[model samples]
Target chain A: MSALIEVKNLTLKFRTDEGLVTAVDDVSFTIDKGQVMGLVGESGSGKSVTAKALMHLNAKNAVYSPESKITLHTENGPVDVLSLKTARELKVVRGGAISMIFQEPMASFAPAITIGDQMVEQLQLHGDLSKAKAKAISVEMLDRVGISDPARRFDQYAFELSGGMRQRAMIAMALSTKPKLLIADEPTTALDVTIQAQVIDLMKDLVTEFHMGIIFITHDLGVIAQTADKVAVKYLGRIVEEGPVREVIRNPKHPYTQGLLAALPKLDDLDAPLTPVAGDIPSPLERPSGCVFHTRCPKIIGDVCKSKLPHDTQVDGSHRVACHLHTEVPA
Target chain B: MSETLIKARDLSVGFKIGSGFFGKSILKAVDHVDIDIEKGSFFGLVGESGSGKTTLGRALLKAVPITGGTAHYADGEVDYDLTTLAGPELKDYRKRAQLIFQDPYAALSPRMTVRDIIAEPLEVMGLTKTREETDARVREIAAKCRLNLEHLRRFPHAFSGGQRQRISIARALVSGPKFVVADESVAALDVSIQADVLNLLKELQRDLKITFLFISHDLSVVAHTCDHLAVMYLGRLVESAPTREVFKAPRHPYTKALFSAIPSLDPDDRGSAQKLEGEIPSPTNQPPGCKFHTRCPFVVDRCKVEEPVLEHPGDGHEVACHRWRELADTLAA
Candidate 1:
């Protein structure tokens, strides 16, 4: 299959009062058409920042490196995302071709306006559609998302809906535009397990039906395992491991990935002790000199880990890991 | 047999809602429930959003009022009836029972230093006579919680989520509580950090001999840490049993569904879980009969009209489902 989007050396940093905090450093990945790429990381790992960079949605204080390039392969041609400056020029990538769903569904929707109006407005903004046509498609998307009484729910405010229903409405709104790419940022984190199950099922079904590429960003590796075709394990703004979901999860190469997998409480083995990744994640301002994960890495090798960054080394056909253990000596 | 630290029979906690004298309605957050927590055991209470697990934890700590039924707390020295214990006896019970909140950021005061936050409890309870004594107690508990003594001088803002939680744990344990209620204490932290906190709690429970009523929605975490487990649905206990027993063979349909809902780490195990349809019903407008019947896949005519009572099905397992036996037989067949 052809690549839908290609990101090369996408480095981003925010100008804070303290200093320039590098949120996304030398990150690169690709998502094929109708494929889902999972970005798994803890807070401040720059997964969300990388996703936001795809649509040029970062704040004004954000700065991108000269080498950073994001090329969106549209039907017409490849569009450079970073080069787009004005809102009009960025419109094609923003909600036109790419749509985002936040963690909190309640905060995503307007409290005063009805759910139907917002969805209809989004549809109209993306393409040329009449008020009647927009409303018709909006209600259909709502019903398609498993919301009961779609017509009645369309007229109700966001506050009237429950947490699960509000999330369904948010999904419906995001999909109403029927964009080519969907960026779901911790969409199921706020939901309960049962409700989260429902949402995950809905997303999987939608992916099959729409055949759209998805960048699923979340901290839950379990959710990522279920939804993603390929997985990228990020830590401290860098991709520590990247490979097919099964390969990375089953045969992890990086110490950070292994630590993450070990930390999770597995239902199959209740007797196993939960061994956490040692030490706390360093503050973004203190960004480690060489390998960002060197502080907490249990499988540290020689002085190279502390002084020099390890380049991504191929473990198998598609599996790649950036760790001192995976790298070969220069001898 | 292990001693019972907390025993509740038909314990209920109801809050009156609405404003006017005429316009008043009771919201029974904790309905009629029976539970016995063995001393020195990590007992877990699992449920969804409106399952009343938090309310039950609070009622046991005497943080909320018990509108009906009875609850007893026994630790060999003092056995206080939680429902009626007031005045001096109630004041004494406060020190013996404490709570660890879910959000460490919200739970800790921004203005107070770690030392002051942990020492606040001892100072209020008068557990320590002098400033030196309070400092000593704070330092000792802080050390036990794996908090740095130098960091205690810094404000809560200086610490990360995991570190802040350690401070919260130190504050809760400062009073030397026998029975502690950890209500989603590790839920807010990342998975890697969550394990550290869980290990800390388990270690502390062993070292201090504290009986923890661990409340969380995540079954996987509870499976490894908690010895006994209770599943609640809409303010009612649907099932209660040993953790291994519940995981091996869950009797209640709700419990089975909960186990299946947890996303497996294996990518190939997709869509295998029996996903429950519909959201949890509002607490104010709860349905009659079985609270879980509205979302249950095996709802019968009787389940729609008549509620099931807790029944002992052997091996110390308790289930409140009428068709559990028949369902088990069918599964076996």
Candidate 2:
């Protein structure tokens, strides 16, 4: 299998009022074709910013390092995402080759626009289709999403639909363009558990059918456990742990991963007390030195964790963690 | 077992909608509910979004009007009928029975500092005679909620989602209430943060001996936090039993489907055999017979014509379903 996308030495900083906040620092990862990769992290961890960086959709305040590279696998050849400056030049990759779903469907969609029109407009942007043909395909896409009376629902506005339906419509709009990559940023956050389960099932099926690479970004460990083929745990914009989803969830080597997993409430054992990492997740503006997690880490040892950042240590052939505890300190 | 702290008999909550020209219809948010919550019990109300779990919690707190039936609240000294509670009795009940809202971000006054946010409850209820007393009470509860005294001086925006929820907890508890209604308190938080808040609540309940009416739409969270579980659907209680018993044997088809819907921590579990179909019916136009018969898979002809009453099947378990006996037999088989 070849890499569908490759991110290398990506470092992005924002000129916030507080200071220059490092959102994503030296973050590098790859997603293979047809694989679902989940970027797990809490708020302000910069998981969403990294996904935004892929589409070059960062705000004007963003400052990216020169060494940062983002390449997309396309029919023509490998295209550098950062090099595409022209709107027309970026269009091929933005919506044609890559599509993104947001946390709130209402924000992404026009409240007055019918669900079908938005989808048709998206298709029209990339493909040369007549109004009637686009309408037909839009109805088909809505039906594909398991929406009852697809034709009727397609005509209804976003507000008219339920929370679950709005999300499904957004998914439909994103997929109707037939993009190779889907950036789902907490797509199921607003949905109910049962509806979330259904949406997860739909996304899984879409991956199989479209052969699309998905960057499923969410704070939910359980959803990742059920869906993602591979997982990367992020802390303060850094990848602390990256491996196959099963290996990462079952035997996480990073203290942060262990803490996060231990914190999740479990139905299997109700008596367990969730020992959350000793303190609050530090603010992005006041990030701790040497190790980002040292501020809240229970097992922070000596001068090594306080003065020097640790290298990525391989726990197994497939698993890797960035922590001083995992590797011996240098003299 | 401790004496019943709350006894709600045939409780119903209805909202008069429209009011004039276009239409007029009675929206029954909670209808014909009967429940007994013992002192110090972590009683859970679980259901889907439109299932009236929150409404039931609010009704118990006297936040909503009780349209029909009687709800009795008696904790040793005071016994006040909820529907008729007013004046001094109602004011007193406000101090004893409080509600913790779902969203911490919205619940806390953003402009107010954490100290004032938590102290507002004590001040409003006149639980403390002076400002200093209120401040002292707020600090104590905040500390109990795992919030530091230093953090109390800052605004809510300065804290994390977890910390803000703790502030909300501090406010709910500063009144020194004997019973609390935590209505989806952990719903807005991440899974990791959820457990932290839940643990604090459990600890508070243990030390204070406060009976909690924990209401949530998520069954998995409820399964872990609650001792007794009550499943509500379309304003009706479908099933009520001990958490262990319900987890072991969910008598109602609704409860069975709910349990199966949860994405099991086990990897191999596909949730293929068990999946609920159709959305919950709109409350305004609820199905007449068994309100749930529209989506229930095992609905016999009788299920569509007559409503099922909450009946004791055996043990302490109660289920409102015509086919629960048959469902239980199938599970046994």
Candidate 3:
């Protein structure tokens, strides 16, 4: 299986009033078919932007480097995502090949229209279907997402449904398109614990049944561990560490990853105090030279970690980390 | 030893719903509940949005009026019934009880400087006679909250969500309150910044000896911060126990589901957990018997009509369930 989506040397910047605000810097990764790769980071880490760049979803002021290339694999051939100029040309990439879900389902959905209408509209965009058939398929998709009374709910407006139901409807709409890749941006962050659990199970089951690759983005490590097959930890627009979820959580090579892991409150244990990463996360405008994480890294090496960016060191098969300690010590 | 500092017995708070100003029907925000918060304890009230835990906390703080039963607040000096709090005595109660709102962005005024926001509580309470005294107290609380004095001159907009929360904590503490209601205080913050705010709250509790009613939907954050936990479901208390005990052996079916729902921080721990089905019923049309019976997996016919009363079988644990005896046997296995 070829790489479903490959991002090589991707650097995105926005020309602001002050100066160039670099959002994603030299970020490169690949998502194979049927794989779930999580992009984990706090705000300003550019995880969402990198996910959005797959479909060239950016402002007019946004600039991508000449070397930056986002290639998508298809039955026909490979297509550069950045080179697609118009909606017709980009249709194969956006909504056709990839579908994105946002944190707030209410905001993403059309308030005036019924949920079925939105799902039908989405289906109509990607495929040709009659009105009656679209309605039947939309209702079926709603039921598939575990929405009860699906037939009756087809006519009810978005506000009539609860938060969890609305989110399920959104998922159903996104999946109705039957895209190859799903970009879920903090899908369960705004939801309750029980609702979150249900959604997580649904997503996992959908992944198994649909056999679609997913780019799951979130700040919560716990959700990533449970939902994502592999994980990439980001700090200030840079990938500090990338590995399978189990490997990264159990034995993290990067200090930033370790700190984040320690910060999470475990249900199994409660006595331990939350140990925060020392020092504040620097403003994106004042990002540190060399390693972006060196400003807050607890295990920063002498001058090497400060002045020079550490090259990627292979910690194990498929696990790589960017840290001077791992690189210099030859881990 | 009088372990309990605040106790509410058969507390019920009602709100008039729909129609005219008088309204035709009453909605019970908090209904027939009993709870005991230990002296100087960090107590967690865990539930969903319409769980009534927030209303219960507000009722305890005298922020909302109590309509039924009684709540007693005692701390060495004199005991005051929360329901009948009136006149000059109520003013005293305001000083002892303060609330830290959920959204720091909405809670603080962007127009006011940090110093002014922190000092407003002290001034309104008339705790300090002069501005100098207020400043001194404000500065001390700010430092304890890990806020710089230089930043005090800046508006709330100048600070991040974490820093604004610190300022909120400083304000809540500046009143020198005995009881603090932290209503989803850290929910607005990011995962990494949440740790900093939690640590700050813990440190303040240690130094000030203030009891906090930490209300949140996030169970993990509550488990890490609170000493004791009370799980609420649709205006009712399902279970109350020590943090370790509740997390370890939750008696209520709702509590069990709450724990199981937490997406495991450990990757290996996934797939083994159970997920809950159905949504929480609206408080206005709550199901008879057990409020959670509509969604609970362990529901029987009897659970559908008879409301279970909170029964204490010794120790610090208390559970409100008819099937707890059967559950204990299965859970212990």
Best by TM-score: 1
Which lDDT value does model 3 have at A235? 85
Worst 10 residues of 2 chain A by lDDT: A270-279
Tens digits of per-residue lDDT for model 1 on A11-129? Answer: 99999999999999999999999999999988779999999999999999999999999999999899999999899999899888899999999999989999999998888888999
Find the 10 residues in a row with the least total lDDT in model 1 chain B: B324-333
TM-score of each: 0.97, 0.96, 0.96
Of models 2 and 3, which has the larger DockQ? 3
Off by over 4 Å in 2: A329-331, B19-23, B271-273, B329-333
Error of 1 at A191 (Å): 1.1
Q: Give the Cα error of residue B219 in candidate 3, in Å.
A: 2.4
Best by DockQ: 1
Clash pairs, model 3 backbone: none
In model 3 chain B, the worst 10-residue window by lDDT is: B324-333
Q: Which residue pairs does candidate 1 place in steric collision?
A: none
